[model samples]
Target: MTVSSETRGLAVVTGASTGIGAATARELAGRGYHVLAGVRRDRDADAIRGPGLEPVILDITHPDHIEALAARVHEDSQGRPVRVLVNNAAVQANLPIEVFAIEEWRRMFEVNLFGQIAVTQALLPALIRSKGRVVNISSVGGRVAMATYGPYAATKFALEAVSDSLRRELAPFGVEVVVVQPGAVRTEMLGRAIAAAGDLPAMTSEQGQRYSGLVRAINNQAVSSTNAGLPAEAAAKVIARAVTARRPRTRYSVGREAALVHVVRFLPDRMLDRILAAALRPHSAVTT
Candidate 1:
């Protein structure tokens, strides 16, 4: 369609404080949709508030915050129909499965998986009324879980599955569910994950010795890949297309790495393993 504010309805984007989510909110607004950009902090709210963008305090994990967001959508004074819900709030940690505490794993799922579901459930009525779409921001990790990316990848994998089921279930209602898998992008999350991975206090001495080099390798690969990755605005454009396209694809890959993962996923497990290991080997310089 037409990219006109008079015709476009409201779009809700979670995790809009920075990176892909922030860029997406801006993009949708620029395309003439009134965007309710979700942010956790007042400063971020202030930062993203302008033009067609309205910042909403939404911590998707908190029921109250989600309820408030749903209420806001239902009670729009302008009577704008809900057009899209972009589930972009997520957390990343690069520790190995054995390194993370049970609580940490649960927290990751809480934010990445359950939080998205809760928000979707709360807003389903509005979406159904408008026959809108759901855009989930997954990652290449969703299809290919690398060393030290277990917890975060697990959540994305589950989200991919959920999107599949939701898509089929919502088809009869005219609601579309689309998954966007993005590879390395220039985002603050990469630096945060690298910093978090360097925390070896969670590992035993022997465990640290065994995995520290792997962690460092992963960090190095992350940095190099992200340095060569697309800008957040590029991914935002894809998401905006997913939002506005008349016949959107079920899944959209944002970067070259993501497209490569799509092709490689069909390879034999052993072959994929060798490829992934070889890719990481170049960065595996042991450091004390």
Candidate 2:
């Protein structure tokens, strides 16, 4: 049913076309919030059709779209506080740094960081008035880097910094900012990322010949291995908690790899490099 809970108020979930964002929108809807499910395509809008899910076309990377989104939010909320904003839309590209183009780097940051910032900026006033909270869905990449994920990881790491700064700055306004770092989750995004990795520098190139095989293998393994990860619904549950918790934590780590992430964070640089090399090095060249 279309929700009308006065206490739960309105929730805006960006990238709601699929994956964690779509799951999160449904979660918030079940919890009594009127969900604005943002998407880029008409089909995606249709996909999320249901009670409490009002699909809107929102391409966060475009300035005009962001402004229109803000206006729509303002109107739907009827000048009231928007209780939650979930910045869950993002994309990933996997390629060795040498094989990655400069424009690719810009595009990653534009969608993952800058676009998120724009949406938040436009909605800050509503958040402040409602004492609302913001939920940013970052990835384990934000905390740990892996081969062929440099460009994507950079954007997430930058997002972590942004979330930290915004968390402290918004404290006085009663507007909470929380980061939910998910290790991995079962979603269609994994397939798309693996498929897109094919476009990296040609295997005939010097650098590509040295690393492309290993890079593709490792990328495939990373995606396929994580097939056992929690469902996107699990990550959505965490985002929901962050939005509704009376005193939410600054960061919440989801998935079984949280302990591993801690180890990666505290290990010596030399030890960490050795570990990564052992795992990521070309298989035929290694021996016990």
Candidate 3:
């Protein structure tokens, strides 16, 4: 468990296939840390080509993958402590909560929440030994819920809650926990959610018909706004800084919009709720 003061230890980052995760892995490497990038596909592993970066095929939802990663990290570190852990993998669901299939909701939680916990638990020893930090890649949705993104936001909200508790519990152990909330980072996530909606049973159900127009408008608005959002690398840099900071913050919002969302957290519940409703409201809606 003893790491030389001069040598930077290993950093584990999940969901390093693309977007924030991939960029974070690269950023950490540039900051003089050995990075184990958790990617889920062969193509993703192939894509992350670098000197200090090593790609591990990791599907966080799978126990086998989690166990294998724990062993791999142990072997790779050679008793050296793990310096950082970033839980950045997530799935998205865009639909009215009333019509969102329970199965799909569960899947989102499995990947975004449960899997994240599993990985963290598996690596807890290494993190504790090194007194390293845990950086969770949450979203602005975690603080402010929006319609049509209920399921996705729900998972993040729960994640933020759990992360808060975990931070308190681990503080005594010298293991800091941090949450990085990004607002509409320029990534394929929004587009992928829209593209996958076509085939979801919830999107084809009767309730879907009733709420289809409202949901479509919300999704489109979200996509259109991405053009003005921060690039994934911006979040990556923030996360990398979190990993190496002498005294890292409990939470960091990476973009202008994310900063706004964080500030709005101080607003009264009624004020915030009204603002979110107005933002998610369809452009053409009947009003009294």
> Which is the winner by lDDT between candidate 1 and candidate 2?
1
lDDT of 3 by residue, 30-141 (tens): 7777788999999999999687788999999999999999998788735556888999999886888887778888899999999999999999998998898999989988
TM-score, candidate 1, is 0.96
Residue pairs with backbone atoms closer than 3 Å in model 2 (clashes): none
Candidates' C-alpha lDDT: 0.92, 0.84, 0.85
Q: Write the per-residue lDDT of candidate 1 for residues 42-121, one digit (tens) a residue.
A: 99999999999999999999999998999998889989999999999998889888888888889999999999999999
Model 2 agreement with the true structure over 107-132: per-residue lDDT tens digits: 88889999999999999998898889
- The numbered model that scores best in TM-score is 1
In each prediction, how many residue pairs overlap at the backbone (N, C-alpha, C within less than 3 A)? 0, 0, 0
TM-score of each: 0.96, 0.92, 0.91
| lDDT against true structure, model 2 | 0.84
* TM-score for candidate 3: 0.91
